[model samples]
Structure formats: structure tokens, C-alpha cells
Target: MSGAPEDLAERPVHGVRGEPFRRLLTTWTATSVADGVRAAALPLYAAVSTRDPVSVSAVAAAEVVPWLLIALPAGALVDRMRCRGTLVAAHSFRAVVTLLLVWFVHSGQTGTFVLLGCAFLLSSAETFADSATQSLLVSAAGERELERANGRFVGAETIGVEIAGPLAAAGLFAWRPELCFAVTALAFGFAAVWILRVSPEVEPVRAAERRSMAGEIRQGAVFVLSSPGLRAVVGTVGLVALLTSAVNAIAVLFVLESLGLAPSTVPTLLVCTAAGTLVASRTTAGLSTRFGGAPVMTGALLVLAGGVAALELVRLPGAAWGAYFLMGFGAGTWNVLSSANRQRLTPGPMMGRVTSAYRVFAWGLMPLGAAAAGPLAEVTSPATVIVVAALSIAVVAGFCAPVLRRSLP
Candidate 1:
């Protein structure tokens, strides 16, 4: 079967270059901000609800477990459906879920278990939504423009999640916790609307064979594992994700307890991180295209290592901001290049499954890392845990440096 219209398929999707692509970016931006607000609020809620690092980290761990548990099923579902409609439905579900959380918070029904349940529900929906949207972008933008398109998406994410959403959530949390959830609900609702308004000029080619779910999942795994480049990328991604999760699991607590900063200022540190990401977004695509994805990834890993190391040496809030800023910059580059590379390597028909499988390997371990961080912090200090994490990240980077240089384009 023929794919998207030849003319539409040939067109590039950059900033405002195509109407449908622009609409997709808008939807992503809005949803990201909403997610950012939720990200900032949930940890704070968990921390406030219980001072135990394990309990607080449990909330974070619950949110990511969906990636490990439901990502494959969700990807299989997405591959068989209309991606756009799937995205809208998923976002709508998130809005409802967030609103319910708002009600629970308002009624003072939010305990640690309740909060974890809500996070799991919200992220389960997100698994489907993210899979569908990423597949849709791959089908819409075409392979040649993958890096550029992903860069734009990452830029929007940095702005929404790091800059606007966190800052807004901080203020709203100070005023009212329910207000933060309410805003998240509204953002998801609006994201659904904006996505619904998008009119794709092209359609994806559907798979003619009606394969069983298990068959499809296996096919995607085979494709990813057989390819050296994908294997390298996934391995590197998993290690980085683990270390990053470890650091983030207690970042807010570190700032408040270790650095003696007020809770109100945690979001400001996040904003600083976002600012660095924004700067990286502008340059990552060009750098990847020029220097190749591997070298760029290597450089980013080193920068991230440096950033994490810096956090140990400097315990002040200002110093933490600078360290996180560097980490964000590295993260921005890695995300854009890695996503684009995955999109480029995977076949269109298997995009959803392949993406899901990749996430399974890459993000599935995040919960474990987070869970480990808490108990480790209880044994040692958060600062000591982060320093160990930094050393681990550097080791992963050193191992991947030569492999990535050999494999990635």
C-alpha cells in the first residue's frame, strides 16, 4: 500500500513549516507543561506526606513502572489503531485522572498509597499516549527530517516542563495543592483539543497482515537486538536512565534538607536546568548532523558526568542550579539525537513496537534505580549517593564512548 501523499511526504516539518506538524508541536508543548506541573507537584506531595525517602521515592518509582509493565501492550495497541485518535483519547483519560486526583487532594484523601495509585494510572495512560504520538511524528515527518523534528519537540518540552510548568507549579503548590492538579487537568484537556484540531496532510501505510500481539512484539525485539546500532543505543540509554533516575529520586529532598533551601526554591533550580536544555535544543540537531550522533552523545555524557560530579563539591542551592543546568544541557542533546536515531533505524510498520521495546530496556530500570536511591540515602547521605551515581555514570560513559563512536551516525 502507498504511504502518505507524495507531496506531503516530501515536505519538511520544522518550525511552522507544516500546519499539521505545528499543531502536533503545540499539543506536545501543552501536554509537556501539564506533565511538568504534575512531575513537580507529585514528588513534593510524596515528600510532604511522608519524610521517609523510600516512601517518597516509591511515588516516583510507581510513575515509571508503567513503562516496564504496559509499554509493550500499549505499543502493540497503538500500532493497530489510528495514532492521532489514540493520542487524543489517552490525553482525555489523563485529564480525567488528574481531575480525580484534584478531588482527592481537596478532600484530604491523598495518602501515600492513594498518591502512588494515581501516579500509576496517569502514567499508564501516558504510555499509550507517548507511543502513539511518537509513531505519528515518525509517520508525519519522514525519516530525513527526524533529527530536526525531534530537536524542535525537545525544545518545546524544555520550555514547557522545565521553564513554565515547574515555575507555575511551585507558585500554585504554595497557594494550593489542588490548584496544581486542576491546572494539570486543564492543560491535558487543552492538549487534547489542540491535537484534535490538527489536520494531517498524509496518512501512514497500514500493515496488511493481522499478526498476533505476541508475534508483533517478538518481531520488534528481534529487529532491535539484531542491529548493533540499536543495541548500542539502548544499552547506553538504559545505563544513563538508571543513573539519572537515581539522582532525581532525591533531588528535591537534597535541596531542601541537604542544602537548606526552602521548598519554594526547588522549582527555580528546575527552571535553571530547563534554561540549559533550551540552549542545547537550538544547537543539538546541527551538531548531530555535523559531528554524528555518537560523538555528540559521548560529549554529552562527559558533560553530564561533570555536572553530576560538580553537585558533590558544591552544596549550595546556587551551585546545584549550575550543576543541574549542565546536566540538562547534556540531557537535551542526548534525547534529541537518540530519539532521532531510533526513528531512523526502525521500520515504519514496527515503529510503535520498536519504540516500546526500546523504552522497556531504556526506561524500565528507572524505578529500580529510584528505589535503590532511597535506601542508599537512608544509609548514607543523599550527597554521597549522588556522588556514587556520578561515578557510575562516568564508568558507563567510558564504556559506551568507544562503542558509540563505532556504531552511531
Candidate 2:
């Protein structure tokens, strides 16, 4: 009880500063590169190997399964454990898994099943790393600067994971898929090293008494579901994730088959979208500061809807790139505003659980979205599926706006 006010008072009006914040940001950037590389390389590997939309979707779904299955328990564990240690351990685990994957690729033994399994294991590690990082940032940056901190974090991620990672991986993947995996392993390994060097003070200590994981997990779920604002945010993000994942599930196929782009050139085209994301991350804090988070969120969603719809209409490369750019920009802005709002609403002790619970709805539905994408593309056209997703996203945004406006911090 006594700590609540002290924690509240920790919020600062200015951007976060100091060595710890820098270290955490560095770690995020490094690991995002690893994620980016894997995201691009692995999908291409699947598409190259199987050439089946369903199989590619399977790989995508496998990556997100941990978010649905283990998120709640992982949240509970995060609340009771040291976040920094978790970060290091998770990255280390990913590094080892990636190395094994490289070996499989080298031996020419990699298949759809093995790729899917590896993706699931690597992303399971990500579940821990992501949850722990969110909790750690609250301590390092304080609640007030969460918007800025998350913006910077997102910006770095967009550049590394969305932009640089894809481009680098595309090049390496074109040469030898094994080289891409080696780079991913190296990135995760380095991220662990940076996180290890972060000072002790930056890591929050959650005093523990032996307690049932079920109870802790329940507490987190109740906190999120009991709050209308959190629920609204979760609902809105879930819808977007569903739609976005569906589009992305077939994105490579759309580019290679529909757009007539080569596999090696896919990442280059995506960089247009990544550029929008990078710009949005740099600008979202100021936009929210001026227009307010709720309105900003609403406006960004409108852009996303329009951009996505435009993609279906446009066949020219320039026009399609523009559409993807708009989607990325809107997505980037919405992410910053939503994340900062969640951080502000959640208490320190419950941060881990609340964040994970939020993701269960927000991200867990991605597999469903991915699964839907393949069949939908087979029946109709990929463009038709994207148009439907865009319209649905717009409706969800409109429906959630009033609740979000009333609830946002």
C-alpha cells in the first residue's frame, strides 16, 4: 500500500534518461534485429520449400501459439522473478535453438515440420523476453515517459526488425538460408550480453512468497477484464491483429505470385511499409501529446483502413507501396498509444500479468488470422481478403473509439 504512491510519484514529465534506459533500448534493438531476420528468412524458407500457402500459414501460426498457450503462466512467473535474468535466459535459449536450426538447414534436412517446431520454440522464448522487457521498461523509464520510451523502443524495432533485418536477411537468404540463421543467432547472443551488463538497480525486485501460479494468473486476468478501458484496448488490438495476421500470412505469396516480385526482393518491397512504421514511431508521441491518445488512435486506424483498402485497388508497384506505407504508419502510431496507455493503467506488481493477459487477446488470435488467410486466398483473391480485413478493422475502430476515449489515461 505504501509503495503505490511512491511508484506513482516516479512518473516524470520528460523523456527517460540514464545508462540503464540506453542499455534496455540497445537490447530491444538487438533482439528485434534477430526477430526481423527470422521473420523474413524463415517464411521465405517455408515458401521456397513447400510452395503451399497453408504450410506457410502453419509456420506463422506456430510462432504465435505460445502467446495463446503460455502467456498467462508466463505472466505469473514474470511477476515473481527477476526480469533481467529472464531476458538474458530467453535470448540465450533462442540463440541455442537458432543454432540447431542452422545445423538442420546446413544438413539439407529442414522441412515444414521442423521449421514450424523451431518457430514455436523460438517464439516461446520470445514470450518470456517480451513480457519481462515491458515490466523492466516501467521501472527504467517510469509511467509518465512510457509514451516516449515505447516510441523510441518501437522506432528502434521498426528500423532493426522491420527495415534493416529484412533487407539484410533477404540478401543473406538469397545467398544461403543458413547464413541468415547464423546472423539471427549472433544477434540474440549479443542481446543477451548487453542485457547482462545492465546494472542491478534497473531491474525491479518483486519480493516473493510461495504462491500458486493459478492465483497470480487469475489476479492478472481479473484486473484486465474488470477494467473497461483495458478490455476496450485489448478488443481493438485483437481485431487488428486478426486482420493484420491474415494479410501477412499471405503477404509473401501475394508479392511473389500476385505482384510478380522475386523472393529475394520481397524484403525490399516491405521496407516501404517499414519506413512508414519508422516515421510513425518518431511522431506518435507528439501527435498524442497534441491530439490526445484516443483521437490519435482513432485517426491512425482510419488511415490503416484506407491504406489497406487501397492495396486491393492498386496494381502498380508505387501505388501498392504507398498503401503498405500507410498501413505501417497507422499501425506504428496505434501501437505506441495503446502500449503507453496500458502501462499507465497497470500497477507495478501486476504489470507482467496484465501485459501478458492483454496480449492473449491482442496477439493470441493471430494464428486464427493466419489460418484464415490461406484458405481465403485460395477461394477468393488475396486482394479480396485484404479488402475484407480492412473494412472489418475500420468497423472495430469506430466501435471502440468511444470506449477508448473515455478510458485512456
Candidate 3:
């Protein structure tokens, strides 16, 4: 189904300056900060609690496994529900879960199982929030300003999740684990409040047009599969995510054991990566516009591969920092361009479902990659697994290049 002509015409001509877009950005930034805290805290806590690679990686796996389990259903639900309400509810749920996690940590019940359960629940909430947020973005910024809006969104995410969030997590986790979680809960609460202020230009689906959940889901899947461009983007992204997860699952371990960095320094190292993402957030749109989306994306993957390979081969703290920065830059560029392209291609009513379907293929493999990393690292080394992942990403880039060149604008 097509969007209303009036809605299309009424989109802000001034880029992402609309009130709805501002509120959505605020909401996303708050949520990103909360996510960053939990993300950094979990692995750090797990590493200290148990040195077992499998156990540590299991925590990482639990967080992303929801993408596989609930992303599609959540997307369908988001399409059916109001985006603002869905976001509010999701954030509220996350706040409650985080409070529970705080209680667990305070009670000295910081077991692997407890961490895994909390991570899974929190990530499940994220699935809904993310799907609804993407749908909301379309309404807030419209198609014309999607690249700029997404660039700002990615910048917020980089700063909040990667920079501010991790830094805060490091300090708070160092001070008291429960304190870190308490802060995360507060962030989620704030996000709920912020999103409530957004007044998006929503066009509700008519009752006559509504279908069964399964049918809607199938329709989304069919749409994604039928488009060769979407298929190439989805498949390439899925492969990249799989390999990247393997590298990330063991990253903390690599820093602590291989580089001999202190726990406090870990977040600082992460900040370097965030710095690169911040740079890309400002530059990706122009780069894509000048060079075309396909070439930029393909080159970004190559840059990421180079970063990982450098990290493996060099093994110095300075080199590690630069490598991560390069990796983040490449990732940020690819993410912004890919998301804008997808949003541009999709119909308004189908946005949520299509986004979810895309993610089911793109991000669903993350758990498998993360889960395997620990065992693989145990057998060889974190460095070995990382380099292998880098090589795999490079290979996928080569195979997907021609399709991306042909399909992406």
C-alpha cells in the first residue's frame, strides 16, 4: 500500500528539524545510553565472575538471541500498534527489568544464569523499541531527510552507547555493579518519557486491510526476498554481522588477556571506536552522495577487514585503538547508507515488517557467531578467531560487490 500523497508532500523541507524528529532523537539517545551501560557492564561482570570464555560469550549471545526469536513478531506488532505507545511500553519494560537486575546484583546473585536471563529480557524489549523506532523515523523525518536523520541518530547512538554509556558504565561498574544498573534503569525511564512527547504523522492501517500476523509476516518476507537489491544487502549484512559478532564476543577477553589492559581502560578503548563512528556519522551522507552508496558500503567493509587484521597482527595497545577506530568508521558508514537505502525502498505500511525481516536475516546470526567465538578462542586464540572473522568479511565483500554495485543507488 502507498502512503497518502498529502503526508508525503507535508514532510519537512528543512531536513530533520521537526518536533517529532527531535523527540525521537532524544528518546533514542537515552535508550542508547542505557543499552551501552548494560552492554559494557555485562561482559565485564561476566569476565570477573567467571574466566570461562564460553560463559562470558554466553552473556553476549543471550543479548542478541532475541533478534532471532522475537524480531519478526515484534515488527508485526509495531506495524499494528502506535509507534509512540510501543516505544513507551518497551522502554518501561526495560526499566522494570533493569531494576530487577539491580536487585539481583545487589543480592549477590550475579550468576551466569541470572545475567543471561536479564540480558535476554532486556534485549527482547530492545527488539520492539528498535522496530517501532524505525517506523517512527519515517513519520518523523520523511523519506527526503532520512540520510541526515539517520546520521544524527547514529551519532547519538555512537556518543551515548559507545562513548558516554561505556565510560559511565566503567566508572559505575567500578564503583558498584548495582549502581550501574540503577543508572541504566533511569535512562530507560527517561527514554519512555521523551518518546511520549513525540507527535508523529502516523497513517493507521485500515481494518479492512489488516491481515493475520503470519500473513503479514510472510508478505514482508516475500517483499524482501523478491527484491534482488534487498536480498544482496541483507545477505551481505548477515554475513558481516556473523563474523563481527565472533570478534566482539571475545573482545573484552582479548583486551584483558592479550593487551593486558585494566578493566577501567576497556571502556576508554571502546571510546576510540566511538570516535570513529562519530566521524563517519558526519561524513557518510556526503561520502555516499559523492561516491555512490554501493562503492562506499563495499569499501567500508574492506576498511573493517583491514582494521581487524591490523588488530590481530600488530597486538599493541596503540595499534588496537586505531584498529577499533577504523572498524567503527567502516561500520558506521555502512550502517547509515544501508538503512537509508532500505527506508527509501520500502513502502510506509510495510516499513516495520520489512525492517524486521531484513534484521532477521542480517542480525539473527549474531548469536551463533558470538556463541562460537568463546569455544573457538579457547581452542586457538582470540586473535586467531578475530583474524579469521576479518578474512571472512573480506571474502563476503568481494562476492557481494558486483550485486551491490548493480543494485544500490
Let me know the TM-score candidate 1 reaches against the reference structure. 0.83
Provide the lowest-lDDT 10-residue window in model 3.
198-207
Clashes of each: 1, 0, 0
Model 2 agreement with the true structure over 75-139: per-residue lDDT tens digits: 88877778888889999999999999999999999888999999999988898898899987877
Instruction: State which candidate, 1 or 3, has the greater TM-score.
Output: 3
Candidate 3 residue runs with Cα over 4 Å from true position: 1-14, 42-61, 103-117, 249-268, 312-317, 371-388
> After aligning candidate 2 to the native by TM-score, how far in Å is the CA of 185 from where it should be?
2.4
For model 2, what is the C-alpha lDDT against the true structure?
Answer: 0.85
Every candidate's lDDT: 0.84, 0.85, 0.86
Off by over 4 Å in 2: 1-15, 43-60, 103-117, 174-176, 199-210, 249-268, 313-317, 373-384
lDDT of 3 by residue, 138-172 (tens): 77888877778889999999888877887799899
Clash pairs of candidate 3? none
* TM of each candidate vs. truth: 0.83, 0.84, 0.84
**Alpha-carbon error at 12 in model 2, in Å?**
14
